[model samples]
Structures are given as structure tokens and as C-alpha cells.
Target: MPQQVQGVIARSKGAPVELVTVNVPDAGPGEAVVRILACGVCHTDLHYREGGIGDDYPYLLGHEAAGIVEQVGDDVRDLAPGDYVILNWRAVCGTCRACRRGRPWYCFNTFNATQKMTLEDGTELSPALGIGAFMDKTLVAAGQCTKVDERARPAAAGLLGCGVMAGLGAAINTGNVGRGDSVAVIGCGGVGSAAIAGARLAGASKIIAVDVDERKLAVARELGATDAINAREGDPVAQIQALTGGFGADVVIDAVGRPETWLQAFYGRDLAGTVVLVGVPTPEMTLELPLLDVFGRGGSLKSSWYGDCLPDRDFPMLIDLYLQGRLPLDAFVTEEIGIGDIEAAFDKMHAGDVLRSVVILDGPDSDSGSTNPLEAHEGEQVSA
Candidate 1:
């Protein structure tokens, strides 16, 4: 039987998301149904609403989610009912060229659930990022469910599913930030701040943060930025160079994704330094950079897709670090809200008032029911 549940959906371009009834089908082959516990409101969701991602209207938003596996379909072995999991968009297909080369993170062909969740009238709703989760329950490919340490709270752990992972991976994976290296991150938003945290975790000697907003820069400092530069005050490129002892940072990350910020990142790094672009830009936006400069710069310019993260590998380790208090995941949660408060959360995000506004679906008043059947199962392997 199809389960009728409430979900947030952007029915049209530039339209407000409506909490409508979404009929989630039972788990089909290689699919699983997850009972959502918590989900974070991300900028990508807003982009979807604005028609920046695609023309996929009536998109079921909210992807940064943690949940419990309520049911698994045929051929699904690793995940069973009652497993706690973090939902990820990228589910690597092992036979893809990238995966065949032992680089699953770069898998060109990722997986989504074969089945679709529809509305009351049978209108097929496009799931945001292939894992629409702003509901009591969502259907997804079993591979999309990455099991993590249950001790890590749902609000913090779910962040690794999207923006946070992108930022952290931009530094640790794509940028190759190393010990004693100098690093700089542009735009001190959630993703940028996560990059700073990643650089700190990697033992970067000096971490610089550049942002137009002083408030975000302050947050970046708490996330381990050694220096802050207000881009509005002066030329950010020159300031970055000056802060890095007149050379430039070894790695520069542009989290704003605009052409101007891209150029700033290009000129703000030392020669032969890596520049990671982790920000999402619009379709109409074009980047104009001097071809001569591109050739003159001796380092790689890389764009991170979901932080180039392999959920099965990175999720467990990062969660362990968070549980040990080594990773301050809690710092990302600016507020907790109910499902109906997502519109207000979007407003807060637009006003730059919060790093993340998470929807708590496990509260007493939540419409979601407890589906975990393993609570009494002692010694259950919960990690990875």
C-alpha cells in the first residue's frame, strides 16, 4: 500500500513550497523506505524552488536527512530494517568507468530509487537530489542509505549528506590541504566554514576566511580560521596574498561560485596552488577568466561534486570524530524547527541569520511513527 505522508514541495518556479500529501510507494527492488528523523534546510533546496537546478517542477525538497530503515526491497543486503542511516544523493554504480578505476567518488552514474513517489492525484513528484526527504518517510535506492554511528544526533549527522560534506571534501579531498599548509576559503557560509574546519582537521598552519558579511566571518573564526578578510573592505586577492606572507595561500576555495569570486580565488592563491570550486552557480551565469592566466597558473582547478565523498567510507569516520568531540558538528545547527517551519527557515537562511535550520521529525508531536525494530538487538554493528 502507498503511504500517504506530508512533504514539502515547490510546485512551480519562484513559488512557495507547499506541505502536500506525498504518496510514497513501498520499497521496490534495490530500494528502501526510510523513516526520517531529521533534515536540514539547504541552499540547494532553495535553488530548486527558484528553477536554478532544473525545470523539474513540483520538486520534493529536503535531502540532508538522517533516518531509520523501515523496509528493504529484494536484493538489498547491507541495510536492514531498523538500521540508522544518513541519506546521500550519490550512490555509486560499481561498473561505471570512474568506479571501475577505483574512484567511486567520481562515479559518473549514480543511483536513485527506481520507483516514484506521487501526489494524491498521481502526479509524479521529482525528488530533490534524487532523495526527497522532507517527509515522514521517503523511498530511495538502498545504496543511498549510508549507515553511521547512531550516537551522532540526526541533526548534525545528516549535514554530511550535502553542503557540509561538499565543503569539507573540497579541502581534504579535492584541494589536498595538508599539514603546515596555508589555506584560504572565500564566502564563510556553511560550506565554506566546513572547509575551514576540514583544513583545521588537516593541520593547516594558517587558515584564512574571506566574506562580505562580518557575521559569517566571525563564525568562520570559530570554525578555525586563523585570519578573516572582509571582501567589502578591500581587494580580497591582495588581502589574501598579504595574509599569506606576500605569496598566497597554498589552497584557495571559492564557496560563493560567482564569476568574480572565482577570479578572486584564482588570483588569491600562490602559484602552483590548488583552487577548489564547491559553490553552486546558476545556468545563465558565465565565468570570464583570461586564458593566458589559466595557463600561467600551474595548479589544478577542480569542482567538487558532493565534496567528492564516498558516503560509506567518509560517513562513519566523520561521525566517530564528531562523537569524540574532535569535529564540532553541533556548531552547524543554528536552530531546530518543525516541518511546517521550513518556509520561515528559508527566510532565516536568506537573511544570513542561521548556518542551518533543521526540521525535527522525531519529536513527540511528529507525524512519523517509530519504525526501528532493532532497539533490543544488542551488539548490532552500526557503523559503516
Candidate 2:
């Protein structure tokens, strides 16, 4: 039987999302149905609502989610009902050229559930980033469900599905920050702060955080940034160079995807240093840099997509790190609110006042049933 549940839906371009009844089909081959426990409001969701990504209307928004597997299809061998999991957007298709070349993170053929979740009247809805988790439940490709430490709170663990993972991956995976390295992260939002935390985790000796907002800078410090620079106060490139003994950092990450910030990142690093662009940029944005400088700069300039993460490899390791108190995943959750507060959360996000406003679906008034069958099981191992 298809499950009827309440979900946040963007009915049209540039319109506010509404909570509507959606019908989720039972898991089919290579799919799994998850009961979402918590889902975070991310900037991407806002982008989708505004038609920045595409004309895919009636978008089922929200993707950064953590939940439990309620059911699995017949072909889903590794996962079963009752598994605690994080929903990942990229489910790598191993037969793609990128995957065949052993770079699954760059897999061109990622997948979502074959079946569609629809509006009550049978209008097919497009799930945001293929997860569409701002609901009581969501269906995804079985490979998109990455099991992690069950002890971690849903509010915290689910964040690894998106921005947090992107930030961490920017430092550890894309930037490749190393022990005794000097690293700089620009744009101290959830992604930038996570990059700082990742740098700390990777043993970066000097971690500089640059942001326009003082509040976000403070949060960056708490996330393990050794130094903070307000971009509004001075030239971030000059400040970063001055702090790094006149050479500049080994790796500079731009977490804000703007032409100006991209230019800042270009000039902010040392010769042969890596520049990691983790921020999403619009189509109209164009970067202009001197051809001489492009030739003179002797390092790799790369863009990080979803932090170049492989769900099977990165998610569980990060969760274990979180459980051991090394990674402050909990710090990402600024506040937890009910589903009705999503609009308010978006306002807060737009105002740059919060790291993450998570929708807690376990609340008393939630439309979801109180007792989750998945939560009843004490111990079950799902192979990664």
C-alpha cells in the first residue's frame, strides 16, 4: 500500500513551500523507504523553490535527513527494515565512466528511487536532490541510504547528508589539508565552519576563517578555526597572506560561490597551493582573472561537488568520529522546530542568523506514527 504522509512541497517556481499530503509507494527493486526523523533546511532547498536549479515544479524539498529504514525491496541485500541511516543524494552507479575509472565520487550516473512520490491527486512531484526528505517519510535508491552510528542524534547525524559533509570533504578530501599545513576557509556558513572543523581534524596547524558576518565568525572559531577575519573589515587575501608569514595558506577554500569570493580565493593562497571551490555559483556569474596570474599560479584550482564524498566510505567514518567527541556534529544544529516552522526556518537562514534549523519529525504533534518499528530493534548490522 502507498503511504499517505505530510510533506513540504514547492508547488511552483518562486513560491513559498506548503505542507501537503504526498503518496509514497512501497519500495521497489533497488529501493528503500525511510521514516525521516529529522531534516535540515539548506540553501539548496531555497534555490529549488526559486527555480534556480530547474523548472522541476512541485519539488519535494529538503534533502539533508537522517532516518530509519522502514522497508527494503527484494533486491536490497545490504539494508533491511530498522536500519539507522543518512540519506545521500548521490547514489553512484558503478557502471558509469567515472565509476569505471575508479572515481565514483564523480559518477555521472547517480540514481534515485525508480518510483515517484506524488501529490494526493496523483500529480508526480520532483524530489529535491532526489531525497525530498522534508516529510514523514521518503523513498530513495537503496545505495543512497548510508548507515551510521545509531547512538548519534538524528538532528546531528542527518546533517552529514549535506552541508556538513560538503565542508568536511572540502578540507579532508578536496583541499587535502595535512598536518602542519596552513588552511584558510572563506564564507563561514555551515559549509565553511565544517571545512574549518575538517582542517582541525586533519591536523592543520593554522586554520584561518574569513567571513563577512561576525556571528558566523564566532561560530567558526567554536568549530576549531585558529583565527577569524571579517572580510568586511579588510582585504581577506591580504589578511590571509599576512597571517601566513607573507606566503599565504597551503589550501584556501571558497565556501561562498560568488565571482568576487572566487577571485579572493584565487589570490588568497600560496604559490602551488590548492584552491577548493565548494560553494555553488549561479549561471550568470563569470570569473575574470588575469591570464598572466592564471599562468603564474602553479597549483590546482578545483571545484568540489558534494565535497567529493563517497557515501559508503565517508558517512560511517564521520559518524564514528562524531560519537568519539572529535567531530562536533551537534554544534551544527542551531535550533530544532516542527514541520510547520519550515518557513520561519527559511527566514532565519536567509537572514544568516542560524547554522541549521532542523525539522524534528519525532514531535508529539507530528503526523508520523509515534512508534517506529525500525527503532524497536536493538542491534542490526547493515553492510556498507
Best by TM-score: 2
Task: Quote the lDDT for 151 in model 1.
Answer: 88
Minimum summed lDDT over a 10-residue window in model 2 is located at: 375-384
Q: What C-alpha root-mean-square deviation, in Å, does candidate 2 show against the real structure?
A: 7.6
Q: What residue runs in model 1 are displaced by over 4 Å at the alpha carbon?
A: 365-384
Which pairs of residues collide in model 1?
none
Instruction: Find the number of clashing residue pairs for candidate 1.
Output: 0
Give the TM-score (vs. native) of candidate 1.
0.94
* CA-lDDT, candidates in order: 0.88, 0.89
Steric collisions counted per model? 0, 0
Q: Which lDDT value does model 2 have at 25?
A: 100
